[model samples]
Target: MAAARRRNSHVQRQRACADSLAEFVERSPSSFHAAAAVADHLASAGFARVEERDEWPAEPGDYVLLRDGAVVAWRIPEEIDDTAPFAIVGAHTDSPGFRLKPSPDRVAHGWRQLAVEVYGGPLLNSWLDRELRLAGRVSLTDGSTRLVQTGAIARIPQLAVHLDRQVNSEGLKLDPQLHTAPVTGPENGPDARSIIAAAAGVEAEDLVAWDLALADTQAPAFLGSDETMLAAGRLDNLVSVHAAMRAIVDTVPSGVIPVIAAFDHEEVGSGTRSGAAGPLLEQVIDRIQDARAVSPSHRARALGASWCVSSDVGHSIHPNYPERHDDGARPIAGGGPILKVNANQRYASDARGAALWAGVCSNAGVTTQPFVSRNSIPCGSTIGPITATRLGVSTVDVGIPILSMHSAREVCAIADAHALERALAVFLAGGWPEHA
Candidate 1:
């Protein structure tokens, strides 16, 4: 009876975690919104929001730094010193989608459309026939940026099956320039700028430029017989982002500092100023050290002793395409979180990192598995290698297994996501025997 009660308790906790994750994803339609959402979660948990130009608090406490669409949050232990190591949880805020192009209003065949540039490698076929929401930050003439998210106002309708009967067998083909433009309404309707400005509660003329994306209008839901499956948009990385945010918010730092780095532009190769490849994470680390009166040399020692868990979604063994995965690399949904491995440095995970993850998961009482892509199918990379190379931190890549990774909507096991959260919480709290 005790074992059964424990199982019931775990199920309830996992369900609650899934619900919380869904709420996080629903509020984050774009990278900017994701950053704000993370900030909100951290602030609610007593983290002070520190600006880049302002001085960070030197005393030990929880702090968060927001940089445009990216955010770097940390927890400083009461006994933190110059040589204190950091257990960092890194994830990206951006996902594969269509970005609204400048002067995006278009008219063709008496139909008004919005021109959108492909931001990342999205499954184009899944985006068709779905209502899309316009979301992102718009720059105003007053030199301020405001996030705007309009309701379902546009759609990329696919060619009817009667017109293209061969689509099922031959596969649907989409042209990003021609066929991917989302139709809004009749050509006589309001322009894109006007509608977007209205959403931002500003006049059209006041809005100068913007960074917008078209997001799926569908809200995340729990599916499957027992409601253990999570279906949502942006699960490719938002799941990891929410996990990191929740973990850091609840963690009380021990000997090591806990940092959550959610950067933008990961899907576009993380080249932007707020991306993992840029100076945001590095600068945040240095700033934290500087505020604590740590010298550059001591900071280097801390960096060398630090560990980063690069969290992103990994592929699950698809039922219809089992051949795409290796024989032993059968990462399944509902099993647990995955430790992504790539021998060619595509992933940052090494033997030592794996052991570190094993120890963390063991302490957290969460089961974990391994994931490696087949030899023929090249594995995609995330912010892991970038963070490892840029900061010289011992990094390990880990994430929950999911299906339809870059689709308009993705699915994952709720238990897996919850397991990831539990493990991340343990890692952020310095559950690994020692800080180093």
Candidate 2:
């Protein structure tokens, strides 16, 4: 009876966590929307919003900062000072997709299309014939920007099989410029910008500039016979974002400062002002130290004691392509969170960091798996190395396991997602013995 009760409780938690995650993904269609959603959620959780133009609060409490498409939130304990070490959880807000080009009006043949360019590497074929929405922010002539998203108004139609006899066996080929323009309406229908302006409650002519992306219109849903799995778009990094945000919101006061940094433009090498490659994290940390009035030597001491956990999604072994993964170490869905390892420094998980993560998970009563790339397969990078190198702090890369990563839609085990949040909560709340 006890075992049965425990199992039932775990199932309920998994479903509840997955439902909340789906709701979050539904609200965030673009990087800007993701950042704004984080800010709003933090506000509701009693975090005071601070702007870059104003002076930061010195008193110990919860605070958040929003910079364009990125968000950084921190919790300061009442017993803390400028010399307190930081317990940082890092994640990214952006995902791979197509961005609408300026002056996207196009009429090719009898079809009216919205011109778009590939923003990042995506599974091109996965986008074909899927209902897609246009979402992002548009700058008005009056210097104000509004977040907007059009209902299912466009689609990238795949060529008919009858017209392309070899599409299945030979595989479909696409030209980013020639084949990827999404058909919005009939050739004589309203212009793309006009449709977009209506969504933002402004005239087309009032739109001075805009940044938009094509996003899948499907809502996340449960999969499998037991309904223990979730399927949704933007699961690559949003899973990490949602997990870290929840952890930070529920964090209690501790000896170290708990921080969560979710940045944009990570899909395109993270070189922008709001990305990990830039100085956003560093600048925010410096301002925080200044407001607390810590001396230089103590600041250095705090820096040495700080630790970061870079969270993102990693690939799960595909049943059909099992050989493609490292035979020795392939994480699977529902196997709890993964500790990513790469001797090449691709992932910043050294022996020390791995030990720290293991202890955190163990203390949280969470199981974990290991992930490594096949020698022939070059591994993808995350914000872990960037944060470690730039900040010169101990860092580890960790994430939940999911399949069909980078697809228009992806799938992950609900249990794994739930386990990740539980583990993150422990890390943020200072379960590790050395965090102070």
Candidate 3:
């Protein structure tokens, strides 16, 4: 009876997480917004902002820092008679969408709309027939920043079915310049600067470099008659990022090393200086050691003791194309966090690390699942392998199973958020099973 009650309570917790994640995405217009929002969450949880400047003593404690709109946080354990290992959780803040290009002042048929280029992998068809809005940061010549927010525009007119009689028989094909183009009336009237100026409370000509993307006008909502599913935009990895940040904050107060990394540019390959594949994390670790006044020898030891969990979206069994998934290893929505694996080293999960994750779930009493691609199909990857290799730490790749991954809007079971959070809480608090 007690176990059942506990499970039910956990479910409620997960439901709250899903709602919070949706809210996060709704507010985070771009990666910059996402990182800022995450920083706020960490601050609210009592983590002092860690800054990078020069060398200093590093010790174990709770810390949060950001690099070019990417956030990374961690909790340094107080019971560090020995070097404490990091319970790292990572996710990307960027999602698939179109970015506004400079000098997008073109008008065709007396319609004025900004020019945009696709960023990351996205389902071009889903974006065709929906109301869209624009939001992002714009840089000023004075070395200051401003935000540009455009109201909902239904300018991207999709082709009607009546115009294409064989639409149902043949799949939809979209052209970036044609089908996805937005119609803004009278381009001759104003330029990109003017559109940005209206939003920034400044003159249009003052607008400099801008980073903007189209977003679905529809807010996230619960789906299904029973409300078992949650639908929202940018859930591909944002869900994981939100959960991990929360779990890390919640665990850090317990005096544990809770590290949360929100890397930038994952969708386009994480090779940028601010990305997970770069030296940002390593540099942060060094700063922590110096801040704590730890010696060089101890810093090396502390690093060796750390562990990482790379959080990203894993493929859920798609109902429309079940054959694309591995029959023996399918992850279902609402089934709990999925452990991703690949023999080609796409994901960082090895048999040993996989067992550790299972242990963490078991200890937390959080239900767990697995995801493996079919032998014939290639697997997509996350930062797990990259981080593990860079730091020489044992890493596990895990995430909530999501449908329509890389789509403009993604879906996932409402209950899985809590499962991942609970499991992460356990892992962050308990340290490694062998040491425990």
Candidate 4:
């Protein structure tokens, strides 16, 4: 059984990682498409779909739903007499990328163009000198809508090497407004009309609204000679979401009610209705109250008994930028999942939660790593802190250590995918003590 589990984990990890990167690239420019992909997966797993307004009261059963690309799914144990304690694993689906505003149109000289705003803190240098395409959601004249990722819309013209002789020595400075505008065509070029026509599915004159941004068409691939590393786009939190899904699916049926949530807009701080810091999770929990009209007292008791794991991405120790990391707490790519800590309470992991997570790693036979920001340096946070406090549940923040977090393309150890799955499975299967 042990060997078989290991073997199965290996296969599952490979398939999950590959599928994750592909989905990440395909569903860019909006979390809506990303959520749709997750909905498809849950549907395939025998989970039934439920609408919030429908008269059929939600009972103790597997249910899933998506909102503007954010997803929340749960399984209600068959024997639930009232509100059962939730074993929840949460991750965000959105990554740092440029977003097209409603009025994306602008004309320069004779060329038509689209305007975009930087969505999150992205590595400006990594975006240079790459083939760029446009993608996102588009609302039509009718009530129905569609996602448009037709093809490469345009490319931000890079300064010529000859114009700047000392280009390599001087590095680069990016003016988002001046240099980032992709040139779709010559002034009044034929390509301009073609792009507008393709986006609207009608003549250029009939187009109403479009939200499009640049994307690299290259597919994700396994990195390193031993294939122990994975390289692809949007690893910030999608990697965590993918790992949580694998873990929940693996251990959900072991008499524990496993829940996996992929919320949108974490990059901009989760302060929205569909964000992790919002009521979507609580609403889903409320839906589980149909079979036994759960009261406020019972709900509080269930919440106190619940456990949550907020999954996000952590910065791996970069070889070239060794000085940027703490000397004693360098998390390597293949090290394992990281237990993030913050003295100022940026991360959700506290002493009690850390110990519980440590035990999960031990039981799963996976190594564990630690991540703490340097005392002198400021720190970045994740959905962990928000979800913990918002839901009022005992929570820990964890993630796969990766390089180039929040960039269009990020790198991570391939083996960490399997390691995270192992740890999360142990967590969902339950045995950890409760905390206040």
**Runs in model 4 with CA error above 4 Å?**
1-29, 81-83, 109-112, 190-211, 253-255, 290-292, 431-436
Better of 2 and 3 by lDDT: 2
TM-score between candidate 2 and the true structure: 0.98
Candidate 3 whole-model C-alpha lDDT, 0 to 1: 0.79
lDDT of 4 by residue, 64-128 (tens): 78776589877776666444577888988787777766666667887666666887787766776
Compare candidates 3 and 4 on TM-score and give the better one: 3
Residues 32-149, candidate 2: write the lDDT tens digits.
8999999999999999999999989989889999998899999888888666788899999989989999878899998899989897788888898999999999999999999999
Query: Looking at model 2, which ten-residue stretch has the lowest summed lDDT?
Result: 427-436
The residue ranges of model 3 lying beyond 4 angstroms of the native Cα positions read 1-8, 54-61, 79-82, 186-190, 252-256
**Model 1 segments more than 4 A misplaced:** 433-436
Clash tally, candidates in order: 0, 0, 23, 4
Query: Each candidate's lDDT (Cα)?
Result: 0.92, 0.90, 0.79, 0.75
Question: Highest lDDT: which candidate?
Answer: 1
Candidate 3 worst ten-residue window by lDDT? 53-62
Determine which window of 10 residues in candidate 1 has minimal summed lDDT: 427-436
For residues 61-159, what per-residue lDDT tens digits would candidate 3 score against the true structure? 566787765898877665653355566787898888888877666677777876888888788887866778777788887888965677775357777
lDDT score, candidate 4: 0.75
Model 4 deviation from the true structure expressed as Cα RMSD, one decimal place:
3.0
* Candidate 1 local lDDT, 1-436, one digit each (tens): 9999999999999998999999999999999999999998889889899988888888988888888899999988878778878999999999998999988999999999998999889999899999999999999999999999999999999999999999999988888899999999999998999999889999999999999999999999999788999999999899999999988877866778999999999999999899999999999988888889998899988888889999999999999999999889899999999999999988999988999899999988988999999999999998999999999999999999999999999999999988999899999988885433
**What lDDT does model 2 reach?**
0.90
Model 1 TM-score on a 0 to 1 scale: 0.98
TM-score of 3: 0.93
